[model samples]
Target: MLRDKIINAISEVGFDEYKEISSADIIFADAVFASCKANTCGNYGQNHSCPPLSGDMDTNKQRFLNYDHAIILNKIMFLGEYYEKMESSMTEVFELLDRLRDQLDDEPVMIAGPGGCNLCDECSAKTSEVCRFPDQKRYSMEGSGMDIVTMSRGLGMTYNAGDNKVGFFMMVLY
Candidate 1:
């Protein structure tokens, strides 16, 4: 029932694509790319919500497993290159995430995304401070400890890695 409910909510999103996972098969996008890592993100320790600050994957998983179902929401960004695509695609991802968050008025949910979190222009990850927008910001999958390529395979989703790759996310709700 929870799974069906989440699927219904996702359908209302009109996203490029959305699916309900029996159990989350999440993977961080950077894990699929050899050159990427949490520290690799300039905002890594600089943002309260990103790595070097946010909790690790084991903790993240404990939280996620509490949920009965998860919904994977994705968009295909056809940007020109790596740097440019990260900017545009991530922006779109946050926008979509914001919309999704707005739609879930009473549902308690957690989302894990692609690369660095730009939820705020300047994150407190640098100052070793608390997050200003605990309700709005989320940690990227790789920023934690998920090996996305492996997770993708578990989900039966083939990750296509390239100079112009498509970024994605997974939101788990209890």
Candidate 2:
């Protein structure tokens, strides 16, 4: 019943594609964690949901394992000729993720999205202060060391839409 509820919420939120998988099936790789340390996205030590602040790889893996089921969600967007609409596309995905979060507000689920948590305009972690909204804090899929590309490919979900279109992913664990 909860799965059905989640599916319905996802439908209402209008994600492009989704698949249900056992939380245990989630792939965690140290290499992915290493990438976070590289700080390509620059949230490494600056966001509570990112590495160094989100905890070590083991902790994050355990957190996901605590859940039995996960629904992977995706939204595809058309980037410009040079993929210039990236920022706006990411914002749209986050907005959709927010809508899904709100739709499932009453459910006991953990959501992991594309990048660092956007629950706040500026994360308190930047000032070394305690997270302002610990209870509502969102987690990042890649930040949590999830090998999303591999997972997506294995599930036959579209990670690359081609033609300058790309897929942004997120997951709801319950």
Leading candidate by TM-score: 2
Q: After superposition, which runs of candidate 1 have C-alpha atoms over 4 Å from their true positions?
A: 1-5, 24-38, 81-83, 135-137, 161-165
Predicted candidate 2 versus true structure: per-residue lDDT over 1-174, tens digit per residue: 888999999999898999999999999888887888999888999999998898988899999999999999999999989989988999999999889888888988988898898999999989999999998899999989999999999999998899999889999999
Flag clash pairs in model 1.
Answer: 27-148, 45-125, 46-125, 46-126, 47-125, 48-125
Q: Judge candidate 1 against the unseen true structure and give its global Cα lDDT, from 0 to 1.
A: 0.60
lDDT of 1 by residue, 40-159 (tens): 657556765555465655665565677666666666666665456666666776777677666665666666666666677777666666777877777666665557656555665536
- Residue 74 lDDT in candidate 2: 91
TM-score of each: 0.74, 0.96
Error of 1 at 45 (Å): 1.1
Indicate the worst ten consecutive residues by lDDT in candidate 2. Answer: 98-107
TM-score of 2: 0.96
CA RMSD (A), model 2 = 1.0
RMSD of each: 3.8, 1.0
Candidate 2: regions farther than 4 A off? none
